[model samples]
Target: MSLPVLLLVILALAAIAYVTGRGRAFRTASGDIRQLHSLPAYYGWNAALSVLLPALVVLLLWISIQPVVINNSVSALISEESVAESSLDLVLSDVRRVADGLDMAVETGALSAADARSLTSTGTDVRALLGSVGVALGSDVSEETLDAAQRYRGMSSYGAILRSVLVLAVGIGGFVIGFRASHKDFRARNTVERVVLGILIAAASIAILTTLGIALSLIFNTVEFFKVYPAADFFFGLTWSPSFGGGSELGIVPLIWATLYISLIALAVAVPVGLFAAIYLSEYAGSAVRAVAKPLLEVLAGIPTIVYGLFALLTVGPLLVDIFGQGGLLGLGWMKGGTAVMTAGLVMGIMLIPFVSSLSDDIINAVPQAMRDGSLGLGATHSETVKQVILPAALPGIVGAILLAASRAIGETMIVVLGAGAAARLSLNPFEAMTTVTAKIVSQLTGDADFASPEALVAFALGMTLFIITLGLNVFALYIVRKYREQYD
Candidate 1:
């Protein structure tokens, strides 16, 4: 069976187990639920967990292991002479794609089962056949690749059948065991609670493990990057140029400068506007106005960042060019084109306003109402109270919110890629086009650059640096939040 069908069967088994366990519990208690150790729902949950969890675990392991086993088996069949010109991994990928295409063709009745089994590259035009069935190959399939794909498909089909059987058996066995264990005296509630606790712990551990995995991956590749490029050149040098050819400069200073400069401009634009909007909505606005205006303001957040990038590219960039471009209204001749640091920064700042407003509004509302009441009781005006008592009380959270926005601005890629032209210069003029580290990272790894070259590997180092900067910002935000948060009696 397919994975989705197998999953549906497992869920059906769990549902059946739930009902059976509940009925068995009722019978054990002589139809008096009061006589049971736990509630009927708890008993049902216990059986459901028993039936579904183990089967799902087995299914996961099977899915994980099947690919490795099948790949290794099929790869062994690929002769060394066949892959002497091309990489083995790329060849294996093509084999898998062709195999999947053949399976799809068989399923759709475009090719008979017999034809799929006895197909040959020379006798049948494999590429043209696959393309006819809506599977396009980059190149014609060789005889060795065709044979490997056929073996792979056969082994995969067998594995799927075996996997379905084993998973169903495990589910059935768990149901039987759980149903038998459901008695009037059994601690069904405690067992279910323990399972829930284990699940929560697993979720937390998975999050930590995922972060660790990302960090380790970046660290390993960054170390490899440093092995090829000098650390001082990457960190302290002033220029930013990367070429696949030897003797290219790989300085990161210009990229870092552009990142901070753009982010600074973004914060300057976002902080005042977003914070003021939050203050108006949370404190001063009538309920009706808040209801209408708040959602409309936050509509900006729901718009995708790529949309903002396009706005920067089309609308904002041209408007700014009209104002600041050479021989324009300002007549300064400073701005040359539509793509510049100012264009990206302004658009990015617009994108971040909703984030700051939404978060800061919540943080401001979280300040105790008693603080505002006391200020008012002391004859302070509403504006005065907000400026003095409420603002200080919520300052820590507001700082954290701003820092979060700053992190977002720093990490923005789409807007930078579209609005800020990809010229890595350290010029102070915001009108001039310059790129950030993120834009450079995308550009560096985009083309046919070899991973072994510093041009490609530097992407990892840039990623690591960006990761560190964001991490440091988060840490500092936490420290400020803890240190300055006012406690109430």
Candidate 2:
């Protein structure tokens, strides 16, 4: 009996239990007791959960602890001479690798005749010795020693059977218990509600844990980076020309400038267009127009950022160069570069239009209709009503949305990678080629060198900065939404 077979058997038993429980619950609820405490479906769900939870918990604990327990036993069996000669970590790595190799060879039918003979002889000796050791240790000697000894034989037939039996027994037990508990008197609804709440809490816990893990990893690495490169050079220095060459320098000011410039340009393009579109849609556009246009605009958002990157590279960059080329647009030859801050920014703005408009429209529509009616009743024009009442009411939300969009623009990688030039420079002209922190991080991390290099460490520092900025923006957005909700509700 393999693990997969055991799992399939368990699943089949659980499914059967669920069906039986549902039927029993339904019959009991329909009896002449006036009414059931909860719905028949809820009772069924409660029974199914009871069947599953304990078995799953056992399985999880078994899987997590089994390796450590096995490894510790194997370590104790190794010769003291061998243990004294090598580091614990190295020996453990080797032992694990050997165990893994044996397992793979057995699974693939690749064990040689010599190896098979050696394994058989060693397994017998190990089993005989391990039993005495286990007895001395005051545990179940025969069973545990036999299972461990089987590892050296390149055979796990008995152990596999036992594992399968245990798993199946647990699953079957859970199913039977859950099925028996499903009755008219059971508080099935409350049980189901508790399960749902538990699931939500688990999901939230995982999210927080993941965030903390990332923050810790970044902080540790950034501390190491600052130790190697002084804080002053990293923070205040203007030059950023780090490379594999001997005289490499690394500074963040130029990258920061490029990021700010590109984001500013993106806001310049997205804000006015998105705001006007939201205003028109909410205050003036007919339902028919809204129905056709809303989803179509959202379709733009659905387009992948990589696709936008290609669009920026092939379509937008060339168009910008052509329009502001040397022979055109007041003979501004200096603005002829195909990849520039403006090109990336413009493309990013296009990408964010849906983000801005959709958020703005929802906030605008959330304003009380009575406010609009009152403004109209006072003989205010539609434009005036929107300008004075709706827009003002939704201002905080709109500002929050814009800040979020700014963060997004700052974090954007694809458009900048394709459209913004790779040269890190601090120039006022948006037409000139420039690079951003994200672009530099990508460049540094992708280089063919040791991962322990100072250049590589810089990426973690940059990532930390980016993470903090985005996290701040999100926190601010949540605050705005909460405040607005309180005001209206």
Clashing pairs in 1: none
The sequence of per-residue lDDT tens digits that candidate 2 reaches over residues 83-171 is 56655555555444444444555455665435533564334453333333332222222322333444533333444555666676787
Worst 10-residue stretch by lDDT in candidate 2?
135-144
- Assess each prediction's global lDDT (C-alpha) against the native: 0.91, 0.77
Question: Which pairs, if any, clash in model 2?
Answer: none
Q: Tell me the deviation in Å of residue 377 in model 2.
A: 1.6
Candidate 2 has what TM-score?
A: 0.78
How many steric overlaps does candidate 2 have?
A: 0
Task: State the lDDT of candidate 1 residue by residue for 1-489, as single tens digits.
Answer: 989999999999999999999889999999998999999988988999999999999999999999999999999988887678677887898898899899989989988999999999999989988887788776679988899999999999999999999999999999998899888899999999999999999999998999899999999999999998899989998988777888889899999999999999999999999999999999999999999999999999899988999999999898998999988898888789899999999999998899889988988887888888989999999999989988888888889888988888889899999999999998989999999999988998899778889999999999999999998898888776666554642
- TM-score to true structure, per model: 0.97, 0.78
